[model samples]
Target: MSNSQFSEERFQQAPVVGILRGVDHATLDRIIPIYINAGFSTIEITMNTEGATNMIQKLSEEYPQLNVGAGTVCDMDDLEEALKYGAQFIVTPITNEAIIRKCKSLNIPVFPGALTPTEIYKAWTAGATAVKVFPSSQFGIGYIKDVMAPLNKIPLLPTGGVTLENIADFFQAGVTGVGMGSSLFPKQFLKEGFEQQLFDHLKAVKSAYESVFQTA
Candidate 1:
């Protein structure tokens, strides 16, 4: 897939990256449509997930409208596998300069995870499209605000602990976007076949996002 397929403008329009981790293929088949229909534009399948590359290729072909990406890419092999399988974007849980440089060389959008101010700045200087403030839960919203106080130019995509209630708060704290997993796609809802409830949940997230960015 061409790097051009990952549109920064589109992502900025609805800056929520739906994370699919450890979800089976059958479940993916059911919920992908719901996710898209609920107004999400970006989704990532973790590389550690079983059959992740295949799922990435399948989703890329099936849902061309959604910006499909690879997450949890820890090494060069993981990065190569992700790119080979048609990942439009790449997300790493740790800041790796080589990976960031490779993605930048390919013109692919890369979000490298970093916790401390030093790591975040290093990731940004290394050509990361955005620095993913992972485990944002541990430090909370105030941490993000503090991080942005000095590094305001670096785009930050906070992952983890992002919920419907505080999704807007994260944005208000100066996050370019957020990555959500269990909080956004509860396994219980999927197991119980609560598709409508899940849909409503996603809609609420979208509404919450718009509430901050005024995309409504």
Candidate 2:
């Protein structure tokens, strides 16, 4: 599917994009199914993590229905490797026009990170699938509201600062979705056998999103 189609589908169902940073092979094998079962349609595995590419491959092969993507992609090499490993989408921590264009050329959806309005606009105009507000917690709801007031046409995803308590507020503030990490998958849930606990936590998070977005 095209980036727009993938994003639209995700928006229609679940807008939570799980970010697995520093997750190893074993941890991924344990948590991936849990994420899918919890109703997260998209996941981003940071490229800097050890065995990230391998993990991406594993997730892509094991869960072909999920949108497995590459995150923290800083350069072309990372993008190429991610695509080779079957990354369905691409996300960068910084607004790199070159990388965005490259992904665009390949028809891969890319969410490049940006902080200021200038950076966000540049990334959006450069063809980013959507602009990710990095360290969004630092900006707070006020900043997000202010930004969206003017750039509502561009889809914004708050990454870094998204918590279970504030997910609804962020969505209310006009974010297309969120990039959630520790808040959704804490270390305790990654233990040898925490499937039930993990599922319960994810269910709560999903509840929070549904309460606000009211997905059918």
Candidate 3:
């Protein structure tokens, strides 16, 4: 595939991806557009989200331009269901080769979670497009630089504890991109009746990234 056709290329350039963890079907219809307008063409809905499979199907059909991924996924059954419901990407909190292989067979991007260098290497060898650096604050940017020094070939997506405040630091530290949840969630938007606050925050992150990475 050409660079123009790969999600990795697009994701890297986007500079940020919106992670909608623990979302429910009730609020999704109103929430998805908030993400779309936030300069986020990619979205991740955790498996534990209420009516996740149904929401994935609906979101995929509604926003054809968005890359909808299934997150917090663990087993083969969840993977199969997620794919059937139109998940464009599959992400897990662990390095499970089975889920990785299934996603590969289906030609979708797979990002398995890893904390240690050994686990990160194993995920990369298993054909993961990228390995998610979970609880990024727990390890910090130094851990990312340390890992990349040796396995520079691997693209790392640092997730967890990724607030808008600290996200730029992670990107500057060489992360492919950051996956954020609570930080990205606009609580006031839902209450104040203006969804644009959330959108603006996302755009702000993109702007920060552009200032740093010329290509972004």
Candidate 4:
């Protein structure tokens, strides 16, 4: 197993990391394979998603080829739970030096959130696999591009507000990858009446991403 230390060699090959935020056990059972089938080798189930740790353990056990990561992990307890659940990577909405060091102690890759150059650099020096530029919608892709100019050595993952139309724009602006939420997963999927629409959204987002980021 590659484990979630997110080694450079493995991460390079993993172009997209699917951020699954609104899943339950049944939803996970249905949705995880969809990402894998769409050529996404990495999947992140946020703590906001119900049964995150249990789902992580289940999905990791079932999908040996796909690397699994935990998102919205806020504390040492979450880190410990993630490790116990066999998560391969850890993600947070904000940078926490303690979480970073704790994950390092267990050899798990930690990608913390940051909005400014100072925070990004601090996260990097703290040993994050990459820094997640959260709420990219509000910050804009250009801001991220600008941030990368001075801190080019740090790898950035832009979450929130990156869509199929602008996903490549983020890449062009310069980000290692994007972590998408509602834009990829629509409201109908959560409701009972629109399963087929969910399928369409999945294919549309995946296809659009393929068209937009062939290099990925």
Candidate 5:
């Protein structure tokens, strides 16, 4: 029950957030334990996905040790609905001051998506728990390293482009953590009975991350 707002603390211990998009209830319920077994301490279900709120609620109730939250939340309504459904945290692809403030008042951590330095700064200043660099693959890890040169004080969570192959590199480049999706949960891996394969893939990613960071 640490909640998603405690990401800074919990994420540092694991540093990987599983992003599950377009997954239904049964599918998510089955695959999520595999993710947890593979060492992901947090899971995010995108709001754009059907039945996302219910998924969050179910996971929160079922997986008390893991932090569950909502992603792709675009507006205040999405934010409100997500919280109502027991989302412990909120993530948006765009910086919305109103939504950020609302989340703050509710004591939930918010990670707003931003691309440019200006937007990143604005989000950070608006009390974003962290700024998620979406489509981070477009700029590459070099961009993250370069951006962190001056803004190193702010916590940056690079998503969208971070893969198992380059995840260690992103951390080396100063990203506090990463939000990974398809790379971790491929479509084929979501099929019934693919749980072991999915678990192995996630295990490999976690192993590689440990090798790179030497955290423990």
Candidate 6:
């Protein structure tokens, strides 16, 4: 699929972007199916990961059902490399206007990280699909709520310190989506080779998200 074809509708079905960082190819191969099976629609492989470009290419081709993206894109070179390898979306840890503009020109969905109001507004004005509030754990859900009060027009995707327990609460606070990393896929499970436990955890997370939207 083309990079411009990111499905916002499909993403809203789950609205959780699973982040993979420093994961080896073998581990990625083992866990992707589990992630997909647990009802995730979006996943990003950080550019800093070893062989990230290759992994993006392979996953994009292998899992057409998944919205394969590249994260940790801090500069123009990283953006070029990600696009060259079929990254359907782009994510950054900082608000890089050049990278955001490039992704915007290509019509690829981009989420640039920001914290303060100034940075967030700057990223939104630069044409980011959504501004990611990085290290959100530092301020917690109340911070997201306060930011949304005035900047309600800007879509926010909070990353860092997100967990199944608080995922629903984040949505309630008016976030467009949430990005999860080690919280969703615990390092302990991966290190110990507890595949079944990890799969179960993902399923539980999905259930928790769905519960928030379920009709009474």
The TM-scores of all predictions, comma-separated, are: 0.96, 0.93, 0.90, 0.87, 0.94, 0.96
- The lDDT of model 6 is 0.91
For all candidates in order, the CA lDDT equals 0.91, 0.85, 0.77, 0.78, 0.85, 0.91
Say which prediction, candidate 5 or candidate 6, comes out ahead on TM-score. Answer: 6
Once superposed on the true structure, which residue ranges of model 1 sit more than 4 Å away at CA? 1-4
Which candidate leads in TM-score? 1
* Candidate 6 or 1, higher TM-score: 1
* Per-residue alpha-carbon lDDT of candidate 3 for residues 1-216, written as tens digits (9 for 90 to 100): 111122565565584667776666656777777667666777888899888888777878777767788898899989888888888888899999988887787678888999899999988888898899887868777888888898888899988877766676777777777787777776665543566676677678767766667655
Error of 5 at 72 (Å): 0.8
For each of the candidates, the C-alpha root-mean-square deviation to the true structure, in angstroms, is 1.6, 2.6, 3.3, 2.8, 2.1, 1.6
- Pitting candidate 1 against candidate 4, the one with the higher TM-score is 1
Residue range 1-216, candidate 6, lDDT tens digits: 344457788799989999999999889889999889888989999999999999999999888889999999999999999989899999999999999998899799999999999999999999999999998989899999999999999999999978988988888777899999999989977754788999999999888877777832
Clash count, candidate 6 = 0
TM-score of 6: 0.96
lDDT (Cα, 0-100) at 104 in candidate 3: 82
User: What number of clashing residue pairs does each candidate have, in the order they appear?
Assistant: 0, 0, 0, 1, 0, 0
Superposed Cα RMSD, model 5: 2.1
Report lDDT (Cα) of residue 90, candidate 4.
Answer: 92
Instruction: Give the per-residue Cα lDDT of candidate 1 at 167.
Output: 92
Taking all chains together, the TM-score of candidate 5 against the true structure is 0.94
Rank list by TM-score: 1, 6, 5, 2, 3, 4
